[model samples]
Target: GAGVSQSPSNKVTEKGKDVELRCDPISGHTALYWYRQSLGQGLEFLIYFQGNSAPDKSGLPSDRFSAERTGGSVSTLTIQRTQQEDSAVYLCASSHGGTDYGYTFGSGTRLTVV
Candidate 1:
């Protein structure tokens, strides 16, 4: 049972730069979500993907932010033109998208935009 995984758990970048955060969801799960948590704040949904199609991108902060999933398992969030306010923990979760299943989250990619 492979769980979710993320790379570069800690990331530091300069303003106006581009950064990519990766996520590996559990096998057999069809639903994946990306959420961002700011300091002392609650989690904010960024995007959601079911299988290979994304039905929700409304949560993405701006056009500068985007994400994609391949093979219905791995996902990557790309931040274009990073800003200081973008510094936060980006969390990835996957589940069966049913009443009984719970989302499993990765440790998260902490982005520090300076």
Candidate 2:
């Protein structure tokens, strides 16, 4: 892809249901990130993966939130037993490697837990 791509642009699920959001980063990019925005709130970093190093999952709100990157290209964010409070736009971004460069972000997947 020329830029970051995310799947299922929008999703609506009942509370307690699980949902999966996907992201495909630009070719040759070495860094990927997942973020969430609730309504008017600012973006919240959920996780980050850099090259072959261990992923930083410090920002995940709870054990129900998890993510994985396969082959360093495609990534997935899974939320188990969704809660209404989890409703937000999930964003994915990729960068060449560092904060020195701006990131290319996906349009985001809007997840709504009813």
For each candidate in the order shown, give its overall lDDT on alpha carbons: 0.91, 0.95
> Which candidate number has the best TM-score?
2
- TM-scores, one per candidate: 0.94, 0.96
Q: Model 1 clash pairs? A: none
lDDT of 2 by residue, 3-71 (tens): 789999999999999999999999989999999999999999999999999999999999999999999
Instruction: State which candidate has the highest lDDT.
Output: 2
RMSD to true structure for each model, in Å:
1.3, 1.2
Q: What TM-score does prediction 2 earn?
A: 0.96
Give per-residue CA lDDT, model 1, range 1-114, as digits (tens).
478899879999999999999999988888999999999999999999986564599999899998889878788999999999999999999998656368999999999999
Q: Residue 113 CA error for candidate 2 (Å)?
A: 0.2
TM-score of 1: 0.94
